[model samples]
Target: MQSPTKPLAYSYIRMSTDIQLKGDSLRRQQQSSKAYADQNGLELAEAFKLEDIGVSAFKGANVSSGALGQFLALIKAGEIARGSYLLVESLDRISRQQVLDSIPVFFDIIKSGINVVTLADKHLYRAGETNFADIMYSVMVLGRAYEESKTKSMRVGAAWENKRKNAGTRKLTKVCPAWLSLQENRTGFDLIPERAEVVRQIFQLADTGNGSFSIARRLNQTAIPTFTKSNGWHESYVTKILNSRAVLGEFQPHRYDDHGDRVPYGEPVADYFPKIIEDDQFHRVQASRRRRLVEGAGRKGPEYRNLFTKIAKCEYCGAPMRFVHKGRPPKGSQALKCTNAVRGLGCESISWRYSDFETSFLYFVKEIDLTATLKAAAERSERATVEQQITVIEEKIRQLTAKRERIFELLTEPGSSTAFIKGKLDECEAAIATEGAQITKLREQRSMADMLPTISADELRSLIASVQDMSAPDIFERRAAVANRLSILVTSLRIAADGRRPKMKGIRTFLESQELNPDERDRLIDHIEKTNKQSQRYNRSFNVMLADGVSRYVVVKSDDPTDIIAEVLVDRDGAISGSDRGMPIGWSDGWDNVFDEPVSV
Candidate 1:
């Protein structure tokens, strides 16, 4: 295969990221080598470009370090080496930087019949050119260039750092994950609601009634995607979420002025931004979390009906009685004794038997015919009145849209005086604003419509039918009913009005129970709203993704909106399907929402 007339070989060009040099200014050298190859009309062979390499000769052609070494390994196997022609961009690009000083070692490269052509010293070398003198001269020049470039790189880096410091740029913009947001400051970040919720969720999970590990396990089970989805989850992420005080939406390291105001840099902002959540709500959720502590610690005694145990008021001190069980003789006996009452307050004969307390409460578990009640509620007369308003809103939105389109026309017309046109523009803008406000008001009404009770009997019947088809487990079904329509009222002793067992005061409504009357509906709504507010005021029901793919939602959980970007999707016929995506703005309007996914008219 060795033809005597054939040209010797080719060369390869490479650039390793030299820490001192700017982006490859080795263009002139590459041009020289190309010129040399072209002038000779040397049948060009292969050219391999080695990039991002730190050292050319020291590190033997390794591509990426991990998981990607297989490709480089194949190249090193030398599957194809019959060619005698090779092209290199420059000599320095091919040779080792440190080996240039060792002239004899540098000359050894041409021994394999591979010529080295470098533009730095403009040396063209074949087997004979690899002598001691040529190697010594070429190495001396290339070494100087390398050291010089490194010096310039150090100077440039220092200048950039120094300029920023002098310009008073102290704060490095921080990418605070959810549970915190950052604002521009000379120093650094301010917490926003987006991140606060994450913080609260973390702490609440740690302090849950079910314990922290159980919370972590549950979170791990859900494939809750974290901020960095590609990296997966970790326990440290979970622990960080729980322990960080950033949940309160306050920078713990920051301080308020003497006037107790947050100087967002210089100006104090009095809750100008949407806060993460209140401290009271977060603390309450944490308090509810049963922590395993040593003996003599305040431990809540189990109650037959402990739902409202320490939370309800006491008769003696007028303060709430702490629920507790004394050991031995009263091991299984659950009692509510007033703490303030013992501290010398009021009536002592206020306690009732735990046996009698929950015995009368068994009616709470009574199952109502959901089909009948929901059917009646959904078909109520009020919904019929509300249905007629949709057409009115549609007509109004159409007119507003037409008016919005005319603003450009009025402003762009020729021969219009500035003052006259300005007035017209202002009038149009005012009208647009009015229309926008009206549209917003209507949209809010539409959203609030779902919050309204199902007064329509027929719709309730439909909902019941749908519910029957839903495969919610027994516990889920019971909780869902409670979430939608149940309320509890607890009081001691029933007041009899005229005769046998007074009809209104003593019992609680719960589980699958419904309002027996219009009055009860109002009462139920009040309690539902009250509980909702309480959940928000005191709970941290946000989630976090740990490094281990575990997801936890802890602290003060409300079933309302979970995140700011959350949406509430509604069909034209007024049934809410739920959120489609987390859109920062409103949902995109399309006819597909109406035609493709039509709701029950």
Candidate 2:
């Protein structure tokens, strides 16, 4: 009788630490697996080594993006031949995850018709042939591995706590302040002469009445290298150096929040290292900063200077129109003047007085005809619906393309009959052609849906009423409120000195920018939500991450029941066309009319 052909084999290896990878651990695992495969009449497949270095098996790393996941993906894609052998050093190497999680993953590999060979235990596990004893043994081994990992985690946590408590007394950690050097014994800090001198110079400049900007410019002129990797000095960097307590020989521990803002963790250790700046000089710098804050220098105002700073540009020189407060105290007038004009440049654009601009802009904002905006929004809504249909057709086209490629591949195989190959190829090509035509038709419909559509008179009036009172007593508050409204409803405003008042260009630009086309599902997911939960179907306000990378809040009424979505409020006003929504209805771009229920048209 002919001997059974040697089963194809693949090896998997993993190490959870740099030390294990650097040592002979990986080598030993490979050697053992190879020996087992040789002895068991299994041929190790070509270029089949899988290694996940410094990845914790106990953390379900294998089930995610690791080598194990790639192995499973290959099996599902039919890249790996059925009835192959998967060789590993042991069960723990496969995964140290809990039995509940790891057992299922093991079963998945086995069910793919691959036999698992654990070299350490000399046990071979086949998918369909597993008995009660085999399962119990696997679970026992996985449980031990999990418990081992848990024990190690607790020990590491305890060690870290002890280190943190004794931090100040010990030498400085791996990374030290640029102005200080780690001690020879690797504990505490020692001043670096060169960097410490730069710290002293920064304090000296601040003490001599030089502002952060002036100091930064002077340092840059002298070619002074900044702290860390930055090549040159900046005003912000100068300010940070002046504010740091490290110059005064203090050690402060800080932790970062989810948003990456720094938060102090514990009380600072005073005199932790040799001082670079005197306590007297440090106190004087602090006083200077406080005095500057009181004098309106580099200080956050009670409000923003104007509603439009970078938004309003000079019609002549194109310089930004900045808000300036002039005259004495209460009589000071707020105006938007071109920066180039103020800086002695020959910008011919006339400065607009804030009061006059506000009066004219408000009047124009009140008179905004939402007719065009409403039509544009309706068109966008229609486009979004058609885009979703296009997405389905595109997916079908992808499948058909793959099928056609597979037919071509099969035709190249030896002994394939010409008649049979031609018949299969013709079938695949026909299906591909049909799907391609469908995609073309869907795209054409999407292009037509892109045309503007109008909203009803009642909806237009409702949108107009929302911005009628865009005024506040505080200049900063007024600008903020007005800017928010104008950014959504008004695209541009210009007040020409030739006698024309400030006029709004309309909300068409704003609406068109916020439009969505759901032709590609991957791209659409960024803007569209399929489920009610993802759509924030509740009264509570929630934020959505738009395709443009802007996170806009969908404000809902607070009093409504959380179970149902009453109305979707967007921008300053929650008009249907005011914000874009994905499809459930026909392709029409414009503000969606609310009739007890949102029905797509």
Which has the greatest TM-score?
2
Error in Å for residue 6 of model 1? 5.0
* Model 1 weakest lDDT span, ten residues long: 495-504
TM-score of each model, in listed order:
0.28, 0.39
Q: Ten residues in a row with the worst lDDT in model 2?
A: 498-507
**Candidate 1 lDDT for residue 305:** 30
Candidate 1: list runs displaced more than 4 Å: 1-11, 17-86, 95-105, 119-122, 130-133, 152-169, 172-186, 199-601
* Residue-level lDDT tens digits of model 1 in 160-206: 33543443334323534464445656344455443354445655555
lDDT of 2 by residue, 142-166 (tens): 8899889878765754564466667
lDDT of each: 0.40, 0.60
Error of 1 at 351 (Å): 45
- lDDT for 475 in candidate 2 is 34
Q: In every candidate, how many clashes are there?
A: 49, 20
